[model samples]
Target: MSSLSEIITSSLQKYNDRPAIWVDDCVYTYGDLSYYINQIRNVLHQQLTSPALKGERICIWAYRSIDAYVGILSGVLSGMPYVPLNPRFPDERNLSIINRVRPKAIIVDKNCEDAASKILPTIKFPLLVFFPSYTQKPKWCSLIKQHQFFSQEELISYPLASISNLEVGSVVNTDSSDMLYILFTSGSTGEPKGVVVSHGNVFSYVNGINTISDCHYDDRYLQHIDLTFDLSAHDMYCSWCSGASLYVTPHNLILFPNRFISEYKINKCMLVPSTAGVIQGHNLLFPNSMPSLKYTFFCGEPLTGSVVNGWQKSAPSSIIYNVYGPTEATIAFTYYKCTGDSVDRCLPIGKPLINQQVIITSSSETAADEIGEILLGGSQVALGYWENEKMTDEKFYSHSGKRWYKTGDLGKLDPNSQDIIFLGRSDRQIKVRGFRVELGEIESVIRKIAKTYFVAVLGDSDSEYENVLGGEGYLNVVALVANSQESKENIIEECKKILPDYMVPSQVIFLKEFPRNSNDKIDYKEITKIYYKNKNSSSISAHNNVI
Candidate 1:
C-alpha cells in the first residue's frame, strides 16, 4: 500500500470483525477501529475548515489509548502530518516542540487533557479535540467544559452512525512523499530536533520487515512501548498493515513485562533491551512463562547476550532479533538474529534491512572490518530534520547519487562474519590521557562481568578538579551498576583485569536501581548529578585506592 490510510481501509474490509486493538478491558475490532477513524475524520473536518490546516502538522498527546491511535491515523488520513508529544514530557519540552512545529491543531485523550489544556492556550487559534476515555476522566475534567469531548459510546451512537451512512472516504490520497509524522529526539543544541519521516519512508520499512519476519494476519502483536518512541511506529503500523491485532500493555503492567506477555498471549513483540533487562534483573522469567511469544524484536539499545540468553531459555519457542537503526532512518533498518551463543557475549547488530544499504566509512573510503562512522543509504533514510536546513545538511548528505544519512554511531564489519558490530556513538567517544575511550565499550565489559543488563559508565577528564586529580582531567571512571551481586571493589578489579588501567573505573557505585528517563532508558544526566554530588565525599575517597 502507498499510504497508511489505504493500509487501514484495506485491513478494515478484510478483517472487519477481527480484533485490531486490545487495551485494558476493551477489545476494538477492525470495524470498530475503522468506524472511530471515520467519526474522528468527520470531527476533524468539522473543526478544521481552514484550508491552511491541510498538509500542516497536528500535534497529538500520544499515550496508550484507542483514541490516541485513531487521532494519529485520522490526522494522517486528513492529509496532514502528525507530531506525537508524549504527555509525560515536561511542559517546557512540549511547548518547545509546539513552537517549533507550529501545529494547526492539537488532539488529546482523557489521560492528557489536563496537560494539554495548560499547553493549548500558548498557541494562537489552536483547534483542540478531546477524546474522553470510558474508564475514567482527568482530575480537572469538571473545571473545563468548553472543549469538544468524544467518548467511544458517543462516537458510535447517533450522529456518528450517520457518519457511517455518509459516503465519505476515510482514506485521503496524498503523494507518498508527504511527511507522515515528526518525532523529536534529544538535540545536541539544547532544543529537541524533529526527525521528519515521509509516508514513503515508513511504507518501505513496514513492508520490508514484514517480508522477512513472521508478522502475518494471525499474529497478535503487543504494543508495550510508548507511542512517542519511534519503535511504537513499528509496533502499530507493522501489525496493522499485516492485519494482525495490536495489544497495548496496561500502564500498571508495564513494569512487569513477563506478566503482560503471558496474560495477553502475545505472539509478536518489539521492545527496547532495557525493558527485557528489567525482567531479567528481577528474575521474573519462569519456565515457559511466555510460550505463545514467537518473534521477539529488540531495538533502541544494545542487545546483550546474557539478557537474551536468559530470555531465550524462558521462551524456547521464540526467535530473538536484534534490530538497530536511528530515527533519521525511519524506525530501524538493520536486522540481526541472535543465536544465544554470540561471540564477545554481545549480539551483532547484523546487516541492513531490505531495500537498504549499510556501509562503514573512514576518512573518504568505505570498507569492511574497518572502524568508522556508519552510513545508511536506502529508501528508509528520512527527509531530514524538520525545518532545520543547516542541521539537515550536516547529517543527511548525497553520496554517489543516493541520499545517505550519517549515523553518528561507530561500528565496523566483522572480517570473518561480515556482520556489523556496533562500537558506540562517534560523538560520545571521550579521551583519557590521550587515549580514546568508548563509554559503551566500558559498559559492555561491565555487563559481561556483572552478568547484568543495565550498566552505565560515565567519565570526563576535563573537569575543574582535573588539575588536582590527574594530568589532563580527573580521569575518573564512575561505573553505575544496577542489580549486580558483585561488590564495588570486586567489579572494579574485574574491569582492571580485562581493561587497561586508564580504562578501569576510578570508582564503582552500586545501586538497587538506575534512574530512568521518559524513554524508560537509564537517566545518565541524573546519574551524573549524583556522581558529582558524591565526587568529593569521604565514602568515594575510600574507594579511590582501588584505581
Candidate 2:
C-alpha cells in the first residue's frame, strides 16, 4: 500500500468507534467513514471500465458535503488525484477548471447536480459522474449525452471494505511522488494556476503538524474553511492524523460561524484572520464566550494583533496560532503560537515546520532585521504548476541541489526573537476576505465586460473592512476606469457573472486619466493615493454592497 493510504487506513481502524466527521446533522464515526470510502471506491471500480485508475484525476464537487469527503478519500485510496470543484464559484471559473483538468471522473452530490448538468455538455471526455448523495439516477442524465452518471443505488449495492481486505493490487499503488491533488489559485496572468501537490508533500505536512500541534482524540475540530481553499485540506488531514473529530461548518455558515461552533462544542477552529475581523466587527465575541475552544488557527491572511486580542479574550482557553505559506507550498510551513498579549497590528508568522525550510532573499537569520521576499523549500513544497512548464520553471528553481519556491510575499525576521514577520505582498495579488484575488484578472474581466481599453483594478487592502465588513478579511476591489460607456451597475452585474463575488468591485471609481510613472506605466501608488483623497467623494465613486 502507498504510505499516504496506509496512514488513512490505520487511523480508521485505530479510531473505529470515535466520531470522525460531522457535516450539518450527518455524523460519521471512523468506521462509518471507512465504509463510505470503500463504497465509493467499489462503485468506481465497477462503473468505470478503465482498469488502471492510478494517477488519474477525479474532480470532487466539494463544499462541506459528505460526498466531498468520501470522494476525496476514495480517490486517495484508489490512487487517483482528487481535484476540488466548488459550485459556489462562477460557472465560467468552474468550467474553465474542468476544461483545464479534463478529469477522468467527477463526484458530486445532489446539491451540485444543477451545476454539473450545466457543465456536462462542455466536457469532451467520457467522464464518469458519481452522485453518492442522490437517491436515484440523476434527472439530468438523459439531457446530457457527454458523461456517464451513477446514483446512490450503485454505492449502496457495493460491498464494504476494511483495511486488511482492501484490494491492494487494484488500488493503493500511488507512489509517494504521485500527485495527490491539484489546487487552483488565482493567477496574475488571467488564468488560474493549478498547483500540483504530491502525496509525499501532504504526508510530510501531516507528519510535521502532528509533532507540534496539540490535537488529540478528545479534541473536536471545526472545519470552517471552504473545501476549495488549501487551508481546508490542512484542517482535514491534521484532524484525522490526531484521531480528532472534525465538525464541518456548512459553507453557508462560514460567514458567521459563532452559533455553530458554540453549539457543537468545537474545541479547535481553523479560521482566516479576515473571518475573525468580521466576527469582532459584529460584536459577537464576548469574553470567554468560546471557552470550549482549545485551539484557534489563523491562516490565508495576516493575523493582526487586534484580531488576536479579540479572539483570545473570547476563546480565552484556546491557543491562538498564526500560520503562513502560499498554496505552492502545501497548506502551511510556518506557524506562530500567539501569547496572551500582542502589541503590533500585524503579528509574527514565526518559525518553519520541522520538514520545511524558508529563506528570505538578500537576508539571513544572522541579519539584525533585513526585509526580502520569502522563499520556501523542503518536503512540504508542492511539485509545481500543472501542465505549465514555462511557469513551473520560472517560479521553482534549484540552489545547491535543493528546490526552492519564491513565495512572492515580502517579510523580515525579527531582530530580537528571529521569528519571521510578515509585511505584505510584493505583487498585484491580495487576499480579499481570505480568497486570493489577482487585480489583473479582475481588470481583464472588466475590460472584456465594458469593452474598454483603459481599466485598472486596485486592491483597497486598508479599507474600513480590513477589520470587518460583516465578511471575511474584506479587501474592496476598487475598479478605476478611464474609458467605459457601461454604467457602474451594469459593469458590476457583468463582473458577478464572470468573476467570483470577492473579485467584483465593491466600488467603481471613474478617472479622466490614469496617473503614469516616468516610464509611462500606470502608477498604482498614485491611483491609491487619489482613491484615499477622494474616499468619500460620491462624484467620482459608485458604490456596491461591500459585504
Candidate 3:
C-alpha cells in the first residue's frame, strides 16, 4: 500500500462486517467505514469542482465522533491534508491557526458548529457541517446560514453505495511522501506551528517495531486523546492497521477511563503521562482493574516510576512501555519497557524503534553516559514544519548523509544497558496535559498583556531550585510579573481571552520588583521563596482562579 488509505482499504476485505469502531455504545463495521469514506469522497467531488482541491487542506473541527474520523480519513483518502482544530479552543487560538493554515475547506460536527459559525466571517471559503441522523436540528443552524450542511442520512445512502476492493485502490491516489495531516502545536515565537507529517511518516510508525509487535487484530484499542494531538494518530492508525476495533472515549468519560476500558474490553492502550498521572491520582489501582489489557504505552511526557509501579500492579497482565519522541518525529520513535529495577525514580526511555536512530552528541567516549542534546534520525522523522522553512531548517538538519531531527530534549545513554535516560529539557519548553508548551510563548503573551519587562513562567519540577516548582501542579501555567498594576484576575482574564486554556496562566503573581542574582538576571529561585512566604496571606484563592 502506498498510502494509509490503501492500507485501511485492504483491511476492509478481511475485516468486512466486523466492528471497526465503537462510539457511544454503537458499533460501526469495516463495511460501514468503507462506505462512509467513499460517500465522503463522492460528496467532495460534487461540492469541490476545482482541480486545485487535489492537495488542498480541509480543517476538521470536532470532538471524538464517528463522523469526525470519516472527515479526517476522507480528507486523506481524497489526497488532501486535514488540519484538525479543537472546537473547545479559545477563539483567538483557533483564529491564529486558521489564518496560518489557510485551509481550502472546513468540516465541523454538531458539537462545534456554533464555534465554527463564530469564525465564519473570518473564513471566506466554503464550510461543511456534519450532524448525526438522529440529532435534532441544531439551535445555531438558523444562525449559521452561510455554510453547506450534510446530515448522516442524506449522504450515507447516496453516491458510491458500495466500496469494492478495486474501487478502494482507485478512489484516491496519493504519494507516500504526500502531506497527510498538519498538527499545529505551541511554538516559541508566540504563534503555533504546524508540524507537517507525510503518509510514509505515520506508515512507518504503524508498521514499525514495538507497535506492531505488541498489537494484534483481535485486540481492542482505546482512543482517549483529542484528535488535535498527534498522539491520537498512534491510536487511530495503529488500531486500523491491525484491523482491530477502536473504542473511543467520550469527553465526559475522560476523567474516568478505567470504566471505559472495562466497558469496551479495551486490550491495547496508548496514553499520555499526564493522563496516567490523573489515573494514579484517582486511586483506581486495584488488581485486575484492567484485566483485559495486554499492553499500555506512555508518551508525550515524562513517566514517573511511581505511576509505572502503580499501573503495573493494576494491569498485571500488561506490559508497560515508556515511549519518547517529539511531534517532529511521527507520533514516537523510541520505546522503553518498564522493569522493576531502575537507577532513578523515573523509567529510562530505552532504545529506538526499528528503522530509527538516536545519538547523544558533545560528549566523550569514556563518559558515554554524559548528558547532551538527543538527536533522532530515521524514516519516522517528519518532512518538516509546514510552510516555515526557516524554522524547519533550524530543527531538521542533514548529518552523516541522513536526515536528523534535533530533539531539543537533553538525555544520556546508560553505558551498561544502552538505554536512553531522559533528563529535563535543555530549554524552557514543557509538556502540559501532553501538549508541548513553550514557556516563552506564555511569557510573550503575558508581557504583551502586562506590559512588563520582567516576566517568568516556571513549570513544576523538583530538580529546579524554586520551592514552588515541586509538584504536579507546577505544570500549571503561572506567570510572575514585575511592575504590573493590573489585578491578578484582570490579567488572567485577559490571558484567557487571548490564549488557549492550556496556554493561559492558572495564577498570576504580582511583585513590586523581581529579585536578581549576582549576575543581574532575575532570580526565579528567590522569587519562588518569596511567593510561598506570601502565599499564606496574599496568594489568590484556588477556586477563584481558573485551572
Candidate with maximal lDDT: 2
Instruction: List model 1 lDDT by residue over 323-374, tens digit each.
Output: 8888899888898988655442557889888879988886233455668999
**Tens digits of lDDT, candidate 3, 1-547:** 6567788777766788788899867899988887777766666766664345667888887778787887887787777899888866787777778777877666667677667667765566556555533244455555656566666675665465234412555546677788899998888878788999988888888877434356677878889888888888888898887688899998898867777787677887888766666666657667778878888888888777777877777778888888889889988889998863433366788999888899898657888989899999987889899899999999998777667999898999988899998887887788876778888888888888888868887654222312212122234677888787677788899888777777778778766677899999988777666655545444433322212
Q: Model 3: which residue pairs collide?
A: 460-474
Report the C-alpha displacement of residue 21, candidate 3, in angstroms.
1.3
lDDT of 2 by residue, 215-243 (tens): 57888888887777899888788877767
Instruction: Give the Cα lDDT of each candidate.
Output: 0.73, 0.79, 0.75
Candidate 3 deviation (Cα RMSD): 4.1
Per-candidate clashes, comma-separated: 0, 1, 1
Clashes by residue pair, model 1: none
Per-model TM-score on C-alpha atoms = 0.76, 0.93, 0.90
Error of 1 at 507 (Å): 15
True-vs-predicted CA distance for residue 137, candidate 1, Å: 10
lDDT of 1 at 142: 50
